[model samples]
Target: MAGRGLHHVTLISSDAERSCRFYACFLGMRLVKRTVSHEDPGTFHLCFGDEAGRPGTLFTLFPWQRVPRGRRGACEAWQTSFRIPSGSLDWWSRRLSEADVPHRLDQTAFGENCLTFEDPDGAMLALVEANPFTQPAVWNSSEVPAAHALQGLHDLVLKVREADPLSELFREVLGFTEIGRNGKLVRLATHDGAGGTITLDETGRLARGQLGAGSIHHVAIRARDAADQDALVQALHDRYGIVTTEPKDRIYYRSVNFRSTCGLLLEIATDGPGVDVDESFEALGMGLKLPSSLEERRGELELLLPSLPIPTCNRHVFEEIT
Candidate 1:
């Protein structure tokens, strides 16, 4: 069966609030969820996306303040790109400049206009004009106007020492169609090129990537629901003899994870029980909303974490809660 599309891409951050300012305020995404990492309570897990925090639009970050800076190399996701409205590249370039975020305007081998930049923590990101046929939800709270706001994730780039095995996994297990190649970079897309694509780069000679601050943790592919996830999990174990985790409730969605051939983490996530399930649509990311297990200790955990604003870019979407 073919994968639906990209669900979300989760990455690391050195400071949650700095990342928030870049993604929510500068980039015009909405902060849809505020929670602590399931495995760690000292750090924060922030989810940013379109207004509703839809599956394909979601991007998450785990702020680990003490982690060392990561170096981009083979066996790592080098960049995460977003789709922007056609002809909005100029607006974004100026906006990023206003925020003092360094960026450069460039084009792909296929001649797609792209604005490439790095986050505060040095994670690579690009904004590419989307296919005009597809429309993205408008985020009204941004410092940017709705017409120029970011759409959602456009694609990801994975650099690996060897491409054949991982390429096989992308086509055989993940159901991505090999579209075309540019030298060492091979592009693959799901859902007949309608959804986000992943470019696997066969970096000839490079060190193995080390995950730390500013590195992508995993790339999630969309699965319809519980049964669909189950089928994919079983296929991994039975057909490919690859081990996959059982479905786990992530509050916003259900997920199953496995390590790829090159040790890159991959996840399959469902699209339901969305961002509004725990918080109201209008009040998303307003305050810390913890799971039932952590609810009793909410006060303690809240004190342990740093405070963040509601992503208004200093223009005030919601009154600052201090």
Candidate 2:
């Protein structure tokens, strides 16, 4: 069976508020959920995405204040990219400049215009004008206008020591089609458009990556339902002798995680019981949310975790544009 598409990308952040300002205020994404990490209760887990916090649009972050900076090398996701409307690069370029975010414009081998930049914590990011202009979900409170708002994740760039094994796994197991290659970069994507693309770079000589702040933890692929996820888990074990962890309840979605042959962590997530399950659509991200398991400890946990400031967009900055 073919994969649905990407679900979300999770990253580690050094400061919660700084990351929020960059993603919510500068990039025009909405902070859809505020909660604590299930694995580490002390760290904050912030979920950002389109207005509804859809699976393909989700970008989740775990803020660990004291973590060291991460170095990008082999066996790591090097860059995370978002989809932008065609012909909006110039507007984005000026906006990034006004926000004091350093960025450079470049084109991929496939001829898509890209604006590459780094987050405050040094995580590599990009905006690619891949698809035609389509109106994305508009957050009424966003500093950016609806016409130029970000669509969703465009693609991810992974650097690894060996590409052939992972490449085979993506095609044979994940149902990705090899679309194109430019030298060492090989592009693959599912037939589904949103968050479906991936670029693999074979860099055998680079050192293994160190996980810390400003590093991507894992990228999740979408499973249409529970049965779809089971098939993917079974295929991994039966065909390649790869073992995956049993599905873990993530509150929003159930996930099964495994390491690819190239040592990159990947997850298959069921696309139900979404972010709005715990909170109403209109009140999302306004209050701290805890899973049932943590509900009893909510009072204590809130006092232990550092409070994050609510992000507000600078209206004057956006008003200056156009």
For each candidate in the order shown, give its overall lDDT on alpha carbons.
0.81, 0.84
In candidate 2, position 42 carries an lDDT of 82
Judged by whole-model lDDT over C-alpha atoms, candidate 1 comes out at 0.81
Give the 10-residue window scoring lowest on summed lDDT in candidate 2.
313-322
Give candidates' CA RMSD values in order.
3.2, 3.7
Off by over 4 Å in 1: 133-135, 192-195, 312-322
Which pairs of residues have clashing backbones in candidate 1?
none
Best by TM-score: 2
Point out where model 2 deviates above 4 Å: 133-135, 138-140, 314-322
Candidate 2 lDDT tens digits, 1-322: 8977689999998877777877888888999999988889888889999899987788999988767888787988989999887888999999888877778999976788999998877899999986642446745455777767888888888998878788899888888889999888899998535688889998979998888888998989999888889999999998888899988998889999999887789999989889999899999998999888989998899888876778766443222112
Query: For residues 1-322, what per-residue lDDT tens digits would candidate 1 score against the true structure?
Result: 7777788899998777777877888777888899988779767989998888887788999988657888777888999888887899988888777667678999875577999998877899899987743456767763778888777778888999888788888787677888888888888888422246888889878988788888998889888888888888877787678898867898888988899878888999987878899888889888888888888888899889987766546643212233
- Residue 74, model 2, lDDT: 90
Task: Please give the lDDT score at residue 264 for candidate 2.
Answer: 88
- Count of backbone collisions in candidate 1: 0
